[model samples]
Target: MTLAVTGGAGFIGSNFILYMREKYPDLRIISIDCLTYASNRFVIDKLSCDANFRFSKTDICDRNEIYRLFEEEKPDILVNFAAESHVDRSIDGSEQFLRTNVLGTGVLLDACLRYGIKRFHQISTDEVYGDLPLEGDDPPFTESSPLNPGNPYSASKAAADLLVLSYSRTHGLPITVSRSVNNYGPLQHGEKFIPTVINSVLRGKNIPVYGNGKNVRGWLYVRDHCAAVDLILKNGREGEIYNVGATDYLQNIELAELICDRMRASRDLITFVSDRPGHDRRYDIDCTRLKTDTGWSPETAFSAGIEKTIEYYK
Candidate 1:
């Protein structure tokens, strides 16, 4: 089977490609990435020697380029991971997020319809459900939850999710959307929280925290996320949305403190700052559907994952 994965050079995409290549050695894989700032080719450089792997530098927003890739590759499975995913950056500039997350998704769905692809997987985020009332003991966001995207980045992702569902309903497209929570592991860029904390502590710099840093997020190890995606792609029901998470919840400040403790850095380096506009107070995902259907659960403990991630940066 030939799989086309967009944004294959980005953090999650690169890790997914590596996982897929190792697990399914005979499967042909074509990765298309625009090599944006967060993209790193070095991650997949070793896979160049594998006959089953191919990489193309292309933008998903360009209709002609996307069409050409579809025609040339004729992928059996299409996974759209291309997006401008940073929340802070999205607050500063939303145009790229809208273009890539919303319009790019539309273009890919159109191409899927034109090409008769078997399965289309849309990688979404828990941020689409926005912040839950931190005051109450409410359950996490589930597939049936209403979307209340707080930031432009999440709004764009929510728009893309709706687009995929529209295509599936109207055009009879075989699509599955997986909404995952905060992912932290190796190869992540320095802008993200975990990496930022680790890098800053190593450099003896203050670890910046937004607000009081009490915002809660469910953390999922990147490899476990890849495993869940693999299961969803193969056995997931069409037009169904699955939430993937490890059920590991931690406050932003708590996470930073854990990193500091692990790295032998003083908590004095922690500095609170003004929160970004539209910052969601907390994000949590209910992975019950995924767990019940696929029997998929995260195997990595938070401490272990953080240690491994920190070591990778070192």
Candidate 2:
């Protein structure tokens, strides 16, 4: 089978391409990426020798380009991972978020309808569900939960989710959406929380934490997320939404301390900074539906995942 993976040069997309290539040696992958600032081509250089893998430097928002690619590749599966994902960046400028997340997703859905693709999987974020109370009184967000995105980034993603579902209902396209929590692993951009903390601590610089550093996030190892996506691509029901997470929640302050401790750095280096606007207080996901439907659970423990991630940055 042939697959088309958009945003293949970014962190999660690149890792997913590597995982798919290794697991299905006979399957071909046509990877299209715009090579934005966070994108790194070196991640997929090793695959250059594989005849089954092809790379195209193209933007998903380009209608003609995306349609041309669909006609040329004729992929059986299409997975869209392209988006302006940083919440802070989105707050600063929302145009890119709307263009890529909303318009780009619409373009891909149109192409899928024209190509008659067997499966279209959309990779989404837990932030689309907005913040949970720090009191821990309310239950975690499930697939059935109402969308209440606070930040521009999340609002754009939530819009894309609706677009995908609309295509499924209006055009009868086979599609599935997976909303995952914060992902941390190697190859992630240096601007991200985990990588920034690890890099700063290793370099003997003050680790910056926003506000009181008490904002909570559910952490999901990147590899485990790839595995869950693979399962969904293979066996997931059409027009369904799945919440994927490891059920591990950590406060920002606590996570920073863990990294500092792991790197043998003193907590004195921790610095609290002004908080970003529209920052979600906490994010937690209820993965019961995903678990019951796909029999997939995260295998990497938080401690182990953190160690591995720290080693990668070191």
Candidate 3:
């Protein structure tokens, strides 16, 4: 089978490509990326000699190029991971986020409709449900939860999700959506939380903590997330939205402290700073649907995953 993965040079996208390549040695994988600042082309370069692997420098927003590529590749499945995903960048200027996240999604959906595909998976995020109370006993967000995006970044994603659902309903397009929590593992951009902490410790610099760093986030290892996406592609029902999350979760401060302890760095390096506008207090999602439907669950323990992550950075 042939699979086209957008943003395959970025963090989770690169990990997913590598995981799929190893898991299905015979699978033909086409990775598409425009080589953005956060993208690492070196990850894909290692596979340059593999006959089953191909890379294309393409932008999802370029409708003509996307259509041309789809016609040539005729991929059986398409997984879109392309987006401007930084919250701070989105707040500074939302136009790019809207263009890439929402409009780019629409372009891809149109391309799918133009050229038939067996499955089109839209990778979404739990931030679409907005923030949960940090101290409440409120249940994690389910698939049916109303979308209440708190930031421009998440708002764009929510719009894209709605567009994907609309295409499925109006055009009978085969589609699946996975709203996953924060993922951490190898090849993550340095701007992300864990990577920032690791880089700061390595450079003997202060680690900036936003608003006391108490914001909570559910964490999943990138490889485990890739496994879940694989299962979703194979066994997930059509036109369904699955929430992907793991049992591992903690406050930002706790995570930072643990990293410092593991690295034998001083916790005093953490410094509280002014928080960003509309920062979500917490992110929680229920993965019952994903687990029940795909028989998938995270295998990486929190501590073990952190150890692996630290080793990778080191």
Question: Which is the leading candidate under lDDT?
Answer: 3
Task: Please give the lDDT score at residue 280 for candidate 1.
Answer: 89
Candidate 1, poorest ten consecutive residues by summed lDDT: 42-51
Off by over 4 Å in 1: none
User: Clashing residue pairs in candidate 3, if any?
Assistant: none
User: In terms of TM-score, which candidate is stronger, 1 or 3?
Assistant: 3
Candidate 3 wrong stretches, greater than 4 Å: none
Q: Order of all candidates by TM-score, from best down to worst?
A: 3, 2, 1
Q: State the lDDT at 193 in candidate 3.
A: 93
Q: Cα miss at 136, model 3 (Å)?
A: 1.6
Model 3 global lDDT (CA atoms, 0 to 1):
0.93
Screening candidate 1 with a backbone cut-off below 3 angstroms (N, C-alpha, C), the clashing residue pairs are none
What lDDT score goes with residue 114 in model 2? 88
Q: For each candidate, what TM-score against the reference?
A: 0.98, 0.99, 0.99
